[model samples]
Target chain A: MSDEKITPLIMPKWGLSMKEGKLSDWLIEEGTNIAVGDEIMEVETDKIANVVEAADPGLLRRRVATAGETYPVRALLGVLASEDISDADVDAFIEAFEMPVIEDDDDAEAAPLYEFAETSVGRLRYAVRGNEGPVVLLIHGFGGDLDNWLFNIDALATSAKVYALDLPGHGQSTKQLAGADLSGLATAVLAFMDTVGVESAHLVGHSVGGGVAATMAFDAPDRVLSLSLISSAGLGREINSQYIDGFVNSVSRRELKPVLINLFADSKLVSRSLIDDLLKYKRIDGVQGALESLSAALFADGEQKTILTEKISSLDVKTLVVWGAVDEIIPASHAQSLENADVQVIQGAGHMVQMEQASQVNDLIKEHIAG
Target chain B: MARTLSFKDAVNEAIDQEMTRDPTVIMMGEDIVGGTGSPGEADAWGGVLGVTKGLYAKHGDRLMDTPLSESAYIGAAIGAATCGLRPIAELMFLDFLGVCFDQMYNQAAKFRYMFGGKAETPVTIRAMVGGGFRAAAQHSQMLTPIITHVPGLKVVCPSNAYDAKGLLIQSIRDNDPVIFCEHKNLYAHEVDVPEESYAIPFGEANIAREGTDATIVAYGLMVHRATEAAENLAKDGIDCEVIDLRTLSPIDMDTVYESVESTGRLICVDEANPRCSIASDVTASVTQEIFSSLKAAPQLVTAPHTPVPFSPVLEDLYIPSAEQVADAVRKTMAT
Candidate 1:
């Protein structure tokens, strides 16, 4: 209750499972003034390493946690205060700091983070976050889960209500696909919206999901507020047939390693964990059949079906088409087909532009949605 | 997003996912599909504790409910492995391994070696090990040492759900016979497990806690106890690194050796009885390999040489507590 402002810079929770993080190094020194969003430290979690940005603006009074040490989430890493605070007061603040007691059992049961909704298609699994705003639905591509939007969901959630879903044939969702084509898949999306009570939502789609989103817009124009397609499938006819064949057939890490390299401009981004994750998805009971059905219906003989370029140009919805310039799955040249849509060809990115350049893509998405 | 999954669900998911991936994979156990011959539901009881519950719905007849004979089904599972089918036979309780030891050790375990590497037995025998539920002597022994002593068998006892899932996947995929032990007490212990399938390689020990003063090596339920002890030790400024030896046969002694060499102190905690247990085995190896680096005699914290008591109070005393581990660490520091 003092006149001087105090801020406790706690350890950030990057992902859902990140319980603690190793504070590798501090970017700023003590007594230095810092602004919000400034990179203050480098924190490494078990999954990935990233910089921790300051969420509060103040004078860096004291460093509470040492570098080269790991601290649990909500544990005070540093103390930020106004310059009017004395050294004794800063010491007292540091001494009195207590970690936010996380009653995990209660926290977990209080709000269901990941939920399942029984749709007409199947029992579809989805993750709903954010309270109130313009609702945005994130649809993953072929063989991907709600996790494909891991980097984007939290970022977009700051300004709008975000929902990322696993379609009928993928993730933890039921593997039964009633119709193999885009029309059937679009109906599943509509069914999910109806079940979740999302009357209308701005749609963000990647790869095959992009095709579904476009079809969804075409089928029900009034329901979709806008459309953002990332490396979408329906925009072009030319596809890497070898990649599709390799993905479907490759079982071991050795065979899949080369196949995954095709998705990223930087081959190093195809991490062992990434390949392992995909292999796990591939191993699930109905994943193979679903992939086969989707592949046959959408990309037959390495050629694209359900091209919506002409239809999208005539449509009234606000559209933004984003593609990785070096995308090997679907060529970046396909981004040009959207006649009146704002198109972006991100450089040095492959099929996973959203994940490759997350911050930039997030900024673009935020701007597009707000506009 | 990763979901909080129970150890039982994780094991079930691993088997279910593996069976889906490989056509040759099959599951067999007594009451695994409870009402196998009865007129009631097909997947009635799914094993004693329902570890294989709901798997029958997706995999259908692949999840077989065998007769009450362990030796017969266990032998058949071993024989099926020599052919092409990858069979996952649940021993019900590891205490029942006595009935089928010949099939596991002599046949499945030795087939590859005796045949000059011509034979491959890719079989996984999953059994519930360790005691906590007042299951008494017959149901409660941690016989990891017996399985680990055999040359051809791969032994794995996971502490948490995530490891349970990954290690089970690796065991199923491996060409050698694997004795995958799941602790009954940790069945309900939850952890963030990925929905997607993944495999954790064998022989790599997971660092449960990292510290500088001492190294505590443990597996299964003892890992949790070691972690608790490490926390209490930290308060007394005695930082202890707790390592989980996920696999017993191909134990990652290198990680343990590195940590012990750095700290010059070692403490081994095992739920198994003191004599010929994992604790004594690890202590002997580390001491023999790196004798000069030792600042003190390696301490072993394990249950006494007696049957797991049925009484609640005696059972509480049967398992090695965090207090005992912390005291052992203090003794090492004093030495």
Candidate 2:
């Protein structure tokens, strides 16, 4: 028996609720040399469709899971081994692979999906992972929740303690807002950190959330170790008012589906369940008013009300601004507004770059936080 | 904020929340506050299925246990509606509507129109409908089409607990009189429902499942059957879209038209009898409006034009089954 290393590309569990994913297409061919963070295949979950990136570099020896077929979480999808590994050994490895059994009882007892914290704004819902190292907080954009960082939370948690929270008026948090402006949201985030006993943390935010993170960093620089903004708002004045208005007014699945497509480069990523979940959230009482108030305060007349580029640039904290090259909601050009910050405009992605290119975004964030 | 709740509990919660929010909201029904004069438990039966079981305790005397006089109480509820009170009268079973048709169709339904828009009848008539508990003909009639046919009345039949709560809230707040049809068989069916009160606007159909091959339209308990059929058909490579027509009156023909236009096939699943039923009505509307979009003649999967049978086996067959819906979808696919 030769000591040859082999890795299995398993179906990734995106969020706490994701049980399985349909392997839609293989992006890379077998026999291709794989690098860490390389896009390997596209997987479709009930919520959204996204490309699965490689976590370990190796030779792509075999593709076991067929395209268009769904596999349970942690079920082996492909084999990644060196050229020295025999075909017989690869076949045996594939045959012996057992899909991870996720016992509902054990899982629920082990890690509760989310926790609630009573903040000054209202009751906030959050998910905390990891126990040691520096703390990192994730803030999601308008109409988003902690689940927006589904792909990144666990990855970042491998290095640092990570916390992702749904802002007031979003997710399972209170729909009543203390205040609906950007500063109001920043205060809520600060209150959440206080309730959770997080003194200082690296802030990773997306879109409106990015603006909130920047505001937190500017107000209390000592509390924010570093800032990683992904397709953030408040750096520019021009905004997709149509998308905002449509999202606010849409009451049916048909009406909301088209509006959500503006957030992703691949429109097909907006699956039926994604729209349904959003519709469910939107239908909650007081949610409509809360969203309307936020939109009015932050994005009045189809333009961003607050521009914090100068303020964020002047801050001494380490900053990283990431944008999707094809971002439609807020122009990717706003990424260049920062004078003394690292900027990365990723190609083939849109406003939701953190989700679309999750592996790259995760790597960048992990490195930035570490630095 | 959302947790699993049965349809029975959801309906109760809707009424309870509405009553708590607005002092003008009141409920009157036969045995709704159960054991009223019996000196036993004050709020005993809580309607036949205990849907309004604990509500009386929360909103005391506001939940009046009316005598078994449908016409009188229904008329009184409609008259109270014109005068500020938003009354909800539980009509027990929809089959009992024959005794109180005039109070609903002529009085409550035509209040605003006949009174030259000066009157507003914000009354909701809650009645249990459909078969499958062996309730037989008199009790398990799907009289939605009868109520929906009227000009001014808004008719709603929710399939699940979430829809039940939201639609019920909307019905209570609606200015026009509403006939809220509760499927007795689906009362125990559970789904995640938010505790807070929210309203789902009428005339907007929910796409229960998305597909590209065919479209199946249904409401009430039939929505579940249609969805099951779509899922089963999916295994056989026959993708079908299922639309839940939550409200019958002010029907969402636009949604039906959009689905049919894409899939180019239509199958309407309704628990009501076939003749002049909602199934036939939707089929006719889709065929007439988007004639060129259809690749095949639309099909209707509904109970045969006969009273609901009492026998266990016959009653099981009397209601439209998932198998029947699948067969209808398969026929459309073949065409």
Candidate 3:
């Protein structure tokens, strides 16, 4: 069998939610010699479009998936093999290929990846991926769940034991706020770390979650290895309060669609399903109250209640601050406020740059962690 | 990483996650575990099409391979659900509902209502439905309306893998019996589904596409077709809003009513036969509720009132196409 020689170029999985991606175009056609990491195809997911780089070096034998057609993750998009392999063999291989069944022995006995940790703050839902590595915790913004890190978590998990948590008042966690203040939310993070038995972790937080992360770094410097804030709050006083107010007030699709558009540079990214998902989250029994309380606590006067810029430099931990240039919620200028932190303002990205430009952000985070 | 999974795999993931979450959650169906008594691999087949494959390894006895008797096993599953075990009974095909529907509607569906709300039958009847499989009349049928007519039962048909996972999770967690109709044709259709278990609430319609010219309501495989039609319609200057009614019993009529009020045109597309189907049901509701708002009468594009033909050509014609839906929208525009 020439199976050992033929390397399948499959549709890459970007996040936990992405099932299939459209092959927009193939950069390296059949019969082209390709090296590892060479750009081969442009794949478009519902969330973003990314180039599929070759993982194996060989001659591009065949492009099985047609351009503009979508294929499932791991479905053979193309085949690369030695020039010695005939077309007939490649055709046979493609015809006989069945999607391999996933069966990892370690995975079978392991606890559910997404587990709830009981803390004094409340029951916090956290997904822990990669069993053995440095601990990394992802904290999402106000109204956002652990899903905000959907793109980054798996990517970061490659090098670290990543944990993305839904804070007390958000997601599937306890809805009732104990204190509802920045400190209260920070304490939840601390309690969650203690509950999960993590002595220290690299904290990557977005929006209000970044505020909570900063507060945690200040409260217990020993517990935080490093901090990476992405378009985070607490760096500036001037915030797009209308965005916050609109997010909190909009209950219907008509009202919510426009509100969500502010989060992205390209309003076209505000998909109907995205709006619907938010509506569903909002409709959860205690979610409305939780969101309202959190919003009030964080942005009481249309400005970030706590500016941690002064204390950020004082913290002993290494810090990285990333902001979207067109961030409507929090200005990219806020990235300049952090005295001791390395900052990058991603061009053409809005508030949700971590999601909007996940690959770039993921690369940044990976680089930061490695450094 | 976000992995693309077929509708079958999504269904499997939902059941697996639920089983892992709750100890009482169990699954039973003929060939679900596969190779029950015959001399073959223990976990072979995994259902008629392998939707429930590999789950047996994780859950073990909780994932059961039942006898060939649908009436007996489905009844047992329903009875078990009433007695604390949340049984997910695979009905194999919706067409087989004839053999065990009494157990479904009469017993499981009615348990909570009839028992004065004391009983909770948290049973999910997972079955493959719809035509285009060339499975002939008996094996292929969108019998969603038959179950949706029942007051106590919750009917759900997801158009994609993401909804399939979430809705199935909701169905299993729900205290009432849920008939989850998996369009056989859509089994291979892939979409992004979260690894973590999340529930999409019942009755919330997903607006697949937003438009101002017309509103197209559909579910299951037809939702995809409606979306295709909406895309085609867009090129011709018709912005058609396509709504996937993810759940039938607790239908989001509010969304439909709102859409029709704005667009002044409604087109319902269902793969199910035209007579008293979901399309007709939506048409009737919209016509009655928003008759004054509508610029033209509501149009319904559905399969003809006949058995699903075996021939590929006949079956292709029998299943309502995107072109037909677009034509219906055009007709609404003309009126």
Q: List the residue pairs that clash in candidate 3.
A: A15-B1, A15-B2, A16-B2, A19-B4, A19-B192
Candidate 3 error regions (>4 Å): A1-140, A143-206, A209-371
Error of 1 at A52 (Å): 3.2
Q: Candidate 2 — which pairs collide?
A: none
Off by over 4 Å in 1: A1-24, A33-37, A44-48, A54-99, A107-110, A178-184, A231-283, A288-311, A322-339, A343-360, B1-100, B103-156, B161-180, B184-188, B192-219, B222-335
- lDDT of each prediction vs. the true structure? 0.87, 0.91, 0.86
- On residues A1-371, what C-alpha lDDT tens digit does candidate 1 reach at each position? 36248888898765444568789899999999999768899776665455677778999988998987888878999989887788888888878877765436447555565788998888898988788778999998876778778668877888899999998888788879968888888999999999989889999999989999999999998889999999998997999989998998876555787998898887866654566567667765467888999889888877987788888888998998899989999999999998888898898789988876666677787888899
How many residue pairs clash in each candidate at the backbone level? Answer: 2, 0, 5
Number of backbone clashes in candidate 2: 0
Runs in model 2 deviating more than 4 A are: A1-4, A27-38, A59-62, A102-108, B36-39
lDDT of 2 by residue, B1-335 (tens): 77899999999999999999999999999999875465588877888778899998899989898888999999999999989999999999999999999999988878788889998999999999989878878998888889888999999999999999999999999998999999999989999898777889899888888889999999999999999999898889898999999999989999999999999999999999888899999999888899999998899999988999999999999899999999988888887
Provide TM-scores for the models.
0.66, 0.96, 0.64
Better of 1 and 3 by TM-score: 1
TM-score-best of 1 and 2: 2
Report how closely model 2 matches the true complex, as a DockQ value.
Answer: 0.75
Model 1: pairs clashing at backbone N, Cα or C within 3 Å = A280-B197, B34-B45
Question: What DockQ does each listed candidate score?
Answer: 0.14, 0.75, 0.08
Give the Å error, residue B60, model 3. 2.0
Specify the CAPRI tier of model 3.
Answer: incorrect
lDDT of 3 by residue, A118-197 (tens): 88877888898776678889999988888777768887888899999988878778877877888999888999999989
User: TM-score (chain A) of candidate 1?
Assistant: 0.83
